[model samples]
Target: MKRALLATTLCALPMAAAAEGELNLYVWSDSIDPALIAKFEAEAGVKVNVDGYNSNEDLLTKLQAGASGYDIVTPSQHFLKIMADQGLLEDIDAHALAAFQQVDPKWRGQWWDEANDYSIPLAYGTAGFTVNRNHYKGPVDSWKVLFEPEADLQGKIAMLSYPDEIIGAAQLYLGVPFCSEDPAEMKRVYDLLAAQKPFVAAYTSDNIENRIAGGEVAAHFWWDGNSMKIRFNDNAPIEYAMPKEGLVGWLDSMVVPKGAPNVENAKKFIDFMSRIENATAQYNFYGHSAPVAIDTATAKYTAENAPELFPTVKVEFSRSCSPAAQDLVTKVWTQLLQ
Candidate 1:
């Protein structure tokens, strides 16, 4: 029996070694450029295999089912909190990540990781609008553009299909807190969103840029980086704007799965990415803020190209939904869409 057991253990060693040198990554499609992956691969000598997901919930479901396959994942801050709470994430060792100090103090010590124990803020951006310059008959400064779709843009505007974003826009317009937990307030926001739904041209998240570029739509609700990417591609006299009602912002974070095999390589990669100059390069390429420590260079880059989004560096307070609130938002959103 001892000799048979020894043979089985020896056979499994090769599989374990293969898994150790390989890092399985699940991320948003096109979130990271291919060149970046090449750099990591050449430097670390580790094979990085990546998969894509369309939504956060899908990532969560997979992680819940034992994420033995994924070593690194890109998740929004809220979901990071959820994963940390469920003990699904590996507690990030600050010592292993010496470059943690390179992160902006503003992003650290937040509710998601009050002690900076679990995740690293990778990228930050906002929810906002994209407008075709030719179609805008007036100032496009507020949520009113969507809530009360202007005559020229009527039937030409596209709204984000997600429940939290749609209802949060209404809540911001209504002057209710962005992440209001009050059930009554949430209901009011839901009603407001439903009222504006008819004016919206099909609920959707993707293809907004295609619709706008093709002139199938005149305006789109979009994330700041995505809007910038679209504008960069075509420079078709399109603009992205934040509403006067105040916009919601999100920090996309990198966290390790609890059972991650390549912990050391993962830490090194994260540290390297958090260097201010390196992070700036990513933001310049991707059009989103990197979470590295703020500096003169970061400021100059933002002021030059994305002034509207730069204001967020000082807009410290942001609303994040609790799980209960998320469930409620989902339920009300389903009804509103129905």
Candidate 2:
């Protein structure tokens, strides 16, 4: 019965039948501007019900646990591949979305969803570290400062709570593959993080910007976009840097989940977000660049003032590691927390 239902849904034609109802959006916290949601509601005559999750794993767990009522979801590129393979997402008809053309060709046909079958690129950025310039005077150019802390940085650093990211950063710093399967390589990453745990002020993924702004820690492992958002809006004396050891690049895309009650509305919302003006507004609000290009003036302003938002160094996109590798990292992460 499950197979039959899925096959039927996949065979159904792309239809905008429910164009003026509710769109249940499950995305990252503070990711969408409420004002934009209000605008979308007013214009489309559709009520959007918004829900938030912090990590991609959180979103995946809910969906896997049979949670429903989410018309749309935002998953990072790596998780998108996993979800797509599991048939957790509905196929997107590129021909049905007029604004699909607005997205850059580079973001389209990505390895995660080749042929753009399951996801639409929403925002893209790098994961790195930020420094409170008021407290740390030395150069913030390398992962060593956070992983192998100097005297000043010791006990004044915050690390991301996610296993894949913290472990991946350690892998890069140690010059190992981001998704290495070698037990020795994995153990080295685990040992590195375990050693740094004593120096870490906290392992957290929530309100990281606020904590940094409030001087809770002198340095943190954070996303470039969030770092920029904090610097611009909170006027925090913080600076983001792509570590000398390659940075991890991520792209979060919009996908309609299987059994979405408002599939048409989800498609419309994705298209609405793909427009240049809307995309620019989102970027300005969240500090993450949309995968689509914006107007020349806005692009120029970003180039001149917020150059760090664009990474120029070597980048490694996050990839799904083998289950055994994931298990090892999770084990070490749990130990570090204890």
Candidate 3:
């Protein structure tokens, strides 16, 4: 339920404080807490400057367009391989860092970066929808609630402005595999979205918690962490769904981009973030599952309170789509919005 004024462009953010050093960060919107950044600054004497993007495509587009001032970027597991394949990230020897040892064994050796050579694991979560329980008195265990809403949620559903996970969700609902290049299969996705368009209150990715909490919309496509945050912090009567179909798994990692302005400072920030205390601070602030060990009682949320974070259903992590498949996804989303 926190509101931050970060915009999509690097120009919207100030450079950094007048410290001996600085680390420029480009990450997902509202993903990092300011207090944590300040703590890093105070501890390392390196000012941390940040800019945010709404989706993975935005980050990829920025880097492809030659925005290289960022020392560290937070990209999901899939986009990590995409950016690295384009040679836009730095090989910071993340695996060799002492803090890497603290990383949960399950999060290590991820396919996105070999042996964690190019990236440091950050927060992980699932993509799903949340329903305001006060409005709907029916079962809440399926994507049907949003895609084919009941009387209560009619014209009161909101989806992410970005298409990455929305398309993945639709694919799951249709039983189509992620990154399916079949045109006929993709057409079904398009048809399904088009059918649900009339029920959409808005397609947005900004201030989602407020929109849902304030009742501007009754159901919303959202991340598990953010949903739990609104529930725990604002005491909102909302439940994040683990659709019977499946959930999209996502892992955001700390990576140093190629041609970064502050190399050593970026390393310092990574080491600082890897510490258990600091990692716990990040988890408590953002409400996402962390790859590093954290003190649970000292944390803000628990499995008992925010069950959404722990999913029993299968979670299909997205992969980098082929050119044709990605283009079809863009077409499906754009056409549906129009």
Q: Pick the candidate with the highest lDDT.
A: 3
Candidate 1 least-lDDT 10 residues: 311-320
Candidate 2 residues lying further than 4 Å off, grouped into runs, are 1-19, 298-301
TM-score for each predicted model, relative to the true structure: 0.86, 0.91, 0.93
Model 1 lDDT tens row, 65-181: 994577788888767778888899988765347677887787888888888877788788777778887777577778888778767877887876666566666777788776676
Full candidate order by TM-score, most accurate first: 3, 2, 1
lDDT of model number 1: 0.71
lDDT tens readout by residue for model 2, 183-244: 78877887898888889998888778777778788998989888887677668899987688
Q: After superposition, how far is residue 128 of candidate 3 from its true place, in Å?
A: 0.5
TM-score of candidate 1 to 2 decimals: 0.86
Q: Model 3, 38-131: lDDT tens per residue? A: 7777676666667777788888888888956999889998899999888999889998887798799988887888668888888999998998
Higher-TM-score candidate of 1 and 2? 2
RMSD of each: 7.3, 6.8, 3.4
Candidate 2 local accuracy as lDDT?
Answer: 0.80
Q: Which 10-residue window in model 2 sums to the lowest lDDT?
A: 7-16
